[model samples]
Target: MKATWNGVTLAESDDTVVVEGNHYFPESSLKREYVSFSNHRTSCAWKGQAHYYSLFVNGEMNPDAVWYYPEPSEAAAQIKGRVAFWKGVKVEE
Candidate 1:
């Protein structure tokens, strides 16, 4: 699978895990230079707190477009450290 925004592929990997209809891509798939920490955060009953990331591509910024569970709830612990993107970002197989 791949994560793309503004025609830039920020992450790509064959080892993505799908949980609750979201594709949790591995951190290794991401292009580190294009992603930065975001102030945004949200909680899911099963997943726990999700940290966000803003994606920068060729000077364009997409805030809170990527999110992950730094420390997941026991129910979602398998996806800990994995990332998922949304808010106009595309994740495709």
Candidate 2:
């Protein structure tokens, strides 16, 4: 899968974990240069707390567009070390 926003590729990986209809890409697959810190956070009853990352690509900012569970619950362990995109970011094959 490939994740893209603002006409830029945020991440691409053949190996992705699908949970709750989102494709979680490997952390290493992300193009870090286009990512920035986001203080935003959300919690999932079964997934634990999710941290966020905003996207900055081609002079546009997509705040809190990426999220991942730093320490997912055992039920969601498969998503560890992975990131998922949203807030208008497209994930496709």
Candidate 3:
């Protein structure tokens, strides 16, 4: 799968975890230079807490567009350390 935004390929990996209809890319697949920590968080009952990341590419900023569960509940352990994107970011096979 590949994660693209503004025509930029931000991440791509053959190995991705799908959970709750979202494809979670492995941390190793991300373009770290285009990512920065975001002070945003949301919680899911089964997934636990999710932390967010802001994406920047070609001078464009996509705030809180990426999220991941650093420490997920047992039910969602498979997605731990994997990231998902939204808000106009496209994930394609």
Judged by TM-score, which candidate is best?
2
What lDDT would each prediction earn against the true structure?
0.89, 0.94, 0.93
lDDT of 2 by residue, 30-72 (tens): 9999999999999898899999999999888989999999999
Lowest-lDDT window of 10 residues in candidate 1? 25-34
* Candidate 1 wrong stretches, greater than 4 Å: none
For candidate 3, write residues 1-93 as lDDT tens digits: 999998899999999988879999998899999999899999998899999999988899999999999999999989987999999999998
Which sections of candidate 2 miss by over 4 Å? Answer: none
Q: lDDT by residue for model 1 over 1-85, one digit each (tens)?
A: 9889999998899998899898998887889998988989999988899999998898899999999999999999888878999
- The TM-score of predicted model 2 comes to 0.98
CA lDDT of 17 in candidate 2? 93
Write the number of the candidate with greater lDDT, choosing between 1 and 3. 3
- CA RMSD of each candidate after superposition: 0.9, 0.5, 0.7
The order by descending lDDT is: 2, 3, 1
**What TM-score goes with each of the models?**
0.95, 0.98, 0.97
